[model samples]
Target: MERTTLFHIFAAVLFLYNLPACLSRTSPNITTDQSALLALKSSVTLPPDHILVNNWTTTTPSSVCDWVGVTCGKLHGRVAALDLSNMGIIGTIPPHLGNLSFLVLLNITNNGFHGDLPEELVNIRRLQYMDVQFNKFSGQIPQWFGGFPNLVYLNVGNNSFSDSIPQDFGNLQKLKVLNMKFNQFTGFIPRIIFNMSLLELLNLKGNSLSGNLPANMCNHLPNLKFLDLSLNELEGQFPPGLQECSNLQVLSLLHNQFMGHIPSEIGNLTMLEKLYLGFNSLEGEIPNEFTNLVNLEILDLQSANLTGCIPSFLFNMSSLQWIELPYNNFFGSLPMNICPRPLLRVLVMAGNKVSGNIPTEIGNCTALTVIDLHENNFTGTIPEEFATIGYIAPEYGHEGLVSTNCDIYSFGIMMMEIFTRKKPTDEMFTSDLSLKRWVSEALVNGVTQAIDSRLIRQEEEHYFAEASCVSSIFELALNCTEESPENRINIKDALALLQKIRLEFQAKLSEN
Candidate 1:
């Protein structure tokens, strides 16, 4: 009887010991995924300050469902996502992660991860969103990436990834966004890329990718809304491909080797809000067809060989806000109907040889905040409205009024006014006591005396030291406004002095 009882006790103990193991295997049926995750955890070496320190410990080894960054499928209890973005984790991506066959989204962006993307990633066939951007991943992107049938978003940008983009990417018919920017990719863009009619955003910016962009761009990419192929070596006449991209909102082709006239067919992209074609070899006039882009907001064509008059239609575009056409061969007069839109704010036309009178109608452009028309060949007597709107330099009326020194003197006077709140033509300043003379005496007495009382008494650090720098600026401004225009400090010298003063002021502020 005693021996049988002992035998029964031993049997019961063994059964209890085995029961926990059986329960563990059955409750979380995703052991393969759990092991893969644990393997991935083992591979990562956390930085000094990381969130994975205490929570990711082996204390509760089996239930990674409750772990940080792991989201599980409700029905199968399998890990469906692993997002370790911007975590400051340093390590190579472990291929074991591919074992999570149910993973739908995997994001490990802005980490210190390096090395090539493992070929095993092809096993994650369910992956629909994968972003490993802004990391140090290198070598050619895997050709097997096309195996992910459900992939909707893939961004591998800002990595050191090199080699040609795989032509096989065209097989991802369901892909909506493909960003491969800031890499060292080369060779022609695959002809098959535009065939994916569902692709809404395709960004291949900041690569050395060379060759002519396929002219049939608009044919297949009917749904492509945002296409950025900027800072590449793309050449040939500007693609008339925009004819089909009617849904396109933003098109940037800057810093490329593109030549020939911008095709008038660009007007076909009626949905375009921002157009960036600057820093290319593009020449000829702004096509009158651009008037069709009634929705255009920001238009930049700077540093190209573009010529002819500034288009009147551009000034009249109701939605136009920022217009930049600097460093082009554009000539004739700037358009006078600048306020037709009333939304016009930034107008940069510097470095062009555009010659004309300052439009007296400019007073109507109340939204004007930044207007850079300097370095052009504008002539005719200055408009009285300009003087009334902003204080004019004393030398503006003199011969050689358009010289660099005149601009410098004006800048110096503006700086003085900024600090002292005293304009050049203030009632307090008589013929003997000019704004410059009043400021110079204040500098002699102590720069603090001339500084605006509100500025001098600020509760911020280095206020006195800042006041002293302001006094020196006043001194520099006075030198810039010297009676002899030839003896005045040039703009270059004034800029250097200002930069030095700014640096000194910053250093003192930092010290406090």
Candidate 2:
């Protein structure tokens, strides 16, 4: 009787101790959520080859937390991170993913994930970085998004996300870089964005975002470095208070509806490197204060209604590389003493009202690749000594009326510069056949002969080579600058072809 009582007591204790584990085995939240996961697994059939996991041979009855790219927290064994980037994932985002309350980082960038973002995702309170860019995601961003107090970096760019930015976004004080570029987002700039003081890089380019940039836009964020509002319906002059953004580096306002002269004080941005104000209605002379921009690299005022001479201020910028002022009303002579800085690469001043003899000093710009002065009122004999103007012509001399042939000659020079990496003036000329003529002859024989010897070593021709892409680019250059203007390709076609060649070479390099 004593042995029976002792055994019964021990069994009772064991049963009582294991009660919680027993209850958890069939709990509704656990079993119900497991069924939901199974349903998600069935809704979208992943191809055999597309499955990223090696350990999980089948989707069967395994826990979702143990799946590839799904990380689980130690405390509750709940999903904490889902990194599904570049998996070529197709099908809608499963709302069942929100069942994991501990989920933090959700990255589905560079995939084919489509349809509306499920509202259930907002339950992920600890989410930090949500990257859904480069996908086909549509519909308005969920309003509950702002409730994710810890959300820091959100990239929904390059998608079909439309409608106004949520006003509640102001609640996400930790948000830093919000890239919504290349989307169909419309409506006025959300007032909520202006209140986010921590934002450093806000890119709304390539969207339909309208309304005047708030006058005090930069007043809230002193730490901003890159502010790209280009290719939008944003009108009104660049906000005057942007001067207070002392840390600003790149500010692109291209292809917008902005009018009036660019604020003269814009030169106060001493740290600015790339300033793109092209394709806007900005008129009047470039601010004289621009001369103060010592660090400026790219200054693109193309297609603006800008008037006056190409500023002498530009020639002084030693760090300058790209100078695009094409299609404006700029008039008067290019500076006579202009000597390009070593870093200078592109000089596009085409389709403007600039009139005067083509400056021979242009040949002194040894670093120049592109010198586009087409469609201007430029007169005088296309500088005959353009290939090697040993010295600057004494001011403007008695030169005659120029024809459209000047563009052809400039085109030839640009092509030679890109290939040979030598200025026309750098002892490259002596005979009647100009640089263009030499390249033309080589192309006729075979482009291999025209390849810049600098691009290859003495005896390494048979191995891996940059030859094929270079050959194609060379042929393109030869076709662009045909002496008969009618035979030459248009600028648009030329640029597109060059870009294509560049991409081809880039792909080759990446693969190797």
Q: Quote each prediction's TM-score.
A: 0.72, 0.72
Highest lDDT against the true fold, candidate: 1
Q: What digit string (tens of lDDT, one per residue) describes model 1 on residues 1-512?
A: 12322343344334333432222235555778777877777887976556677676567664676678876655555777787888888788788988988787788889988898888989999887788998998999889988888887788999998999998998898887888999999999998888887888889999999988777777888777788999999988887677778988888999999889988888887888889999999878999989999889899999988999878788888999999999998888867766865677678999998898978776566455456787889898765544322334545533325567666766777788899887665668776887788888988887777788887776866777878788778889888878777888988888899999999988888888
C-alpha lDDT of residue 113 in model 2? 81
lDDT of each: 0.79, 0.71
Q: RMSD of each candidate?
A: 13.8, 13.3
Candidate 1, residue 402: Cα displacement in angstroms equals: 10
- Candidate 2: TM-score? 0.72
Q: Number of clashes in model 1?
A: 0
Local distance difference test, candidate 2 = 0.71
